[model samples]
Target: LRADIYPTLESPSATDWADRMALPVASIMWTPVASVTPDTDIRRVAQVLLDTRLPGLPVVDDNGLLTGFVSRTDILRAVANDPPLDVWG
Candidate 1:
């Protein structure tokens, strides 16, 4: 039978430990960047959003500077049926 123990298993190698320690911390922002032009229609914008599979698209001017963001929630909210679901922290 299996037992519930506070500490278990063999010790990890120093190399393995060091590799884990060398990794970046969780505080880093890890989202992919997506951009779109100002004149692009919502239909085309929707396609880009789907192709990229990202939550938000960064709206940009002709010069490729960030102007605004169009998120998944924004797209979902556009339809009259239902609101997007809440995700808990």
Candidate 2:
């Protein structure tokens, strides 16, 4: 199937290069994105990371505020030096 592949924080590797060549570009593509607010719960944020496979999510607060962003690395740090918890659930 043809689809747009956006690069994440990490650099694209050889596998990614191969995929880009193998797949054809689709005429139209729609990807649903999930955003988080400042008040959003950490559990939910972790869930989003697992579900979306996105490196990060934009953090938009209520009152139309743009506070900052959150990434997988940020979550890793939160879990201390140990491995991150199972976010799959």
Task: Give me the candidate number with maximum TM-score.
Answer: 2
In the range 1-89, model 1's lDDT, one tens digit per residue, is 01111124256567755765576855333445567777878777788878966667889998878889887777777643344455552
How big is the positional error of residue 9 in model 2, measured in Å on the Cα after superposition? 19
Best by lDDT: 2
Kindly list the per-residue Cα lDDT of model 2 for residues 1-89, writing each as its tens digit: 22235444256678876776686545233344477998788779989989977788889868656689999888778775456466665
**For model 2, what is the error of residue 58's alpha carbon versus the real structure, in angstroms, after optimal superposition?**
0.4
User: Local distance difference test, per candidate?
Assistant: 0.66, 0.71
Cα-based TM-score, every candidate: 0.50, 0.53
lDDT of 2 at 23: 64
Instruction: Write down the TM-score for model 1.
Output: 0.50
Per-residue error at 45 for model 1, in Å? 1.3
Minimal lDDT window, size 10, model 2: 1-10
